[model samples]
Target chain A: MSEFEPKIVAYCCDFCAFAAADLAGAMRLQYPPNVRIIRLPCTGKVDAIHLMKAFEQGADGVFVAGCLEGQCHYLEGNLRARKRVAYAKRLLAEVQIEPERIDMFNLSSAMGGRFAEIVKEMTQRIKEMGPANTDRRQQPVES
Target chain B: MIVADRKPLEEILDSIKDYKKIMLMGCGGCVTICFSGGVKAVELLASQIKIARKKQGKPIEIIECTPERQCEFEFIDAFKKDLESAEAVLSIACGVGVQTMSERHEDTITIPGQNTKFMGYPVEHALWEERCAGCGNCVLEWTGGICPIARCAKKLLNGPCGGSSNGVCEVDKDTDCVWQLIYDRLKKLNKLENLMVVRQPKDWRTSTDAGQRRVKFEEAML
Candidate 1:
């Protein structure tokens, strides 16, 4: 059987995670190409609806990479994002989706190595989980 | 404000499963403030429903509308055309607003998308706590602005119930005994003597126990 290549969406905060991604490129770090990063002003800008919409648009996995705890550029944006990510997981589970498909990560802008590692780790986890059941029979939305 | 919560997605989906075209009516009043029913909520729900239906290969159409206040007839009238075209209406408003929709659009079926919770205020961003009981009586003056009817677990009018221990209600350990709050407030205000006066039982007729209630604005009469 051919190996699964998951479609992962990563929301990277501009001040840290996005910078880390840029650093990874500078350091010649290699990570799976399955991840597509969307840069945001802050992790707090990543709403629960955005995570759900990623799944709705056929993303196999979604992650929010934010600044390290107590080091957010916007004071508590990362903390708020962490809480929202937790909420999104429960919301996904309520709709019968795998909660593990979504996650939140925190790291400093200098952690380029860890940034690459997270991408590879997330890709591996999602690949093991296989493609999301986008084709599964969803509950009828409206009667 | 009247706080409400969205019904479970499964229940909401099930309620309108048979309809191909539906109107999602949002309210801009209390429900909007509570984040349960509003323009954004309507859009989010519509997108969710569309995605769910698409996955199942059972495409459905949703028309969205948000009125200033669903309970007001004037705001609901604005969606007359949309209401006519949709097979059913999913109202994400309080019970009063839902009823208004039904009354306003008697030819169309109106489904409630939220479970009306209580008259409360948001303590913080997303945290809401019940604050009013609408008991048709005003005793805040004697209680030093604290309401025993709503905040009290036992609704004791006289003093703290035996269940109160260390200022917490017995029914729920997390709940503060409202009687204790009232006592403290009265003590602070030097109105502790008010607690000694015996009060008559509340007249239930002033509340829902009198059946459907109405307020007629005499000055606004046509």
Candidate 2:
């Protein structure tokens, strides 16, 4: 079997990225099978705690995908999501984790090909960075 | 409301680095409403600390609890049973709550997890701005509900100093001129003369620096 595939958690807005992922499958656009998608009503509902928990739970990489700016079904949800991602980035940096491990993207439901590209790109980036340091599973054995 | 913000995760982790058992106490009153020392914030901090400790191969036990209002003894008393198990207490409350916890639990070390900012109100979701000086005075009726002493950059009482331009203060172009706001509000209420009345100099001793501020109830006391 191939080496352990990096586990990526994708927080997708129910209106956009989630639909795009579904479309990608329908179109048979094959991407790495490392991504685990979590559907959120709006990107804004994805708080810093969720990102941190994803890391703590051993996610090698995480990304939040929301609707394009000013197109959120819940007005300003994407904007708020952007701010939360930025805040979480700062927090991850302070903990010695490369903030780039967590990212945010904006796309429409029709962007199936784009969603596939994102998954491939994030999977490669995480492979280069190695496993997440925040993973509790990798803790050193105590005497 | 007393505004505050959570301490950085690293700093919070460092505080309890030596303690094996820690109680992360949250306040459900002023700091809660501000989103700083609330139950959600306490849980977040606790989870982060646990993860950080586990990553370092250290074993730590964290207990999370929230007092109804840390400033009052009645609320803080609820944590007496939990505090018995922890060596240190992390208070996610305003300065008053931290002090109250410290006073009540002198044997156990207490750490503050929030930096008290001000007495303020929410301007928007997750955004708060200070509004009161707590100067032991109520001048809102005279100033048409705006506190020039706090909101005004210059603290001008009689009128907007000539430094005001286009309804904004000269001290900071972004800040609204308190005198201008007072003028507009008084104009709307048809109390223009209220602005012209000479105001007495405020008594500074009655404010926070004077001594402990107290509210006594005569018949209300049981």
Candidate 3:
């Protein structure tokens, strides 16, 4: 059997992490191609519902990537995003999904190498965890 | 506003486990403001239910609806058409909203998704503290806007029960002795004499002790 390639979703803020991803591409930094990046104007815009929706849509893992602490373009957007990410983690755990499936990372636009490192790190973690077993059921029994 | 907390996901899942489909109703009033039963909350819960149920091979359909005010008859009437399609209803509103939905939808099985906590306001984002006991008497005039009935340990109408220490209630260390707060606030306002005027024994008839109470709006009558 072929090894499982986990599908990871990254909600990256345009100000930092999204820009960092762009920088990684520009600098030719190699990271796993398993992650699909969704860019938002700010990390604060990434809500708990959005993270859960990503999982519902077949993401093996999800992460909210924002700017470093106290450095949000919207003053406290990154901080707020971090709090929401924690809340989403708790919510995921309640549904029996591994809380490690979701996480939050802080980075700066200048850290292209660091962004690549994080992508590799998260990809490796999720690959080790394997694809979500919740996906085993494809047919929803209709009454 | 009436603050509430969502019941445990397991408890809620168990309640409608037998049903194949249900209407996930949300309230746009207090529960919405508290982040317990708003549109976003309904969406999150629906996703969770789907994910959880799908894993167990028992996926259920959820028809989501958020009325402007679930307790209001006119607002709830808007969802009558949607209710026909749902086998049951999971109302994520306060107890009043659940009762209202049940009373209005006589044929449908309506269940609560939240536990109505108390008449209170949010202290901060996602944190709520009780502010009123609904004693049906206004004592804020003398108590400096604090309700001793709700905040005090012994519901003392007069002064501190003396069980308080350093302004903390003896019943619970985390609670502030409301009488002490009332004293300081009244003293600041130069109204310490308000405490000296002994209050008459409270009439319990206005409270829950008298059973369900109703207020008739003569102006709104047909």
Q: Evaluated with TM-score, which candidate comes out highest?
A: 3
Candidate 2 per-residue lDDT, tens place, A26-67, comes to 999999988999999999899888988888777879999999
Which candidate would rank higher by DockQ, 2 or 3?
3
TM-score of chain A of 3: 0.93
Ranking of all candidate structures by their DockQ, best first: 3, 2, 1
In model 3, where do residues sit more than 4 Å from their true spots?
A136-143
Give the per-residue lDDT of model 1 (tens digit) for A86-113. 9888777766678999999999899999
Off by over 4 Å in 1: A135-143, B54-57
Docking class of 1: acceptable
Between candidates 1 and 2, the one scoring higher on DockQ is 2
Task: Give the candidates in order of lDDT, highest first.
Answer: 3, 1, 2
- What is candidate 3's TM-score against the reference? 0.94
Model 2 lDDT at residue B66:
92
Which whole-number lDDT from 0 to 100 does residue A17 have in model 3?
95
- Where does model 3 sit among the CAPRI classes? medium
Error of 3 at A21 (Å): 2.2
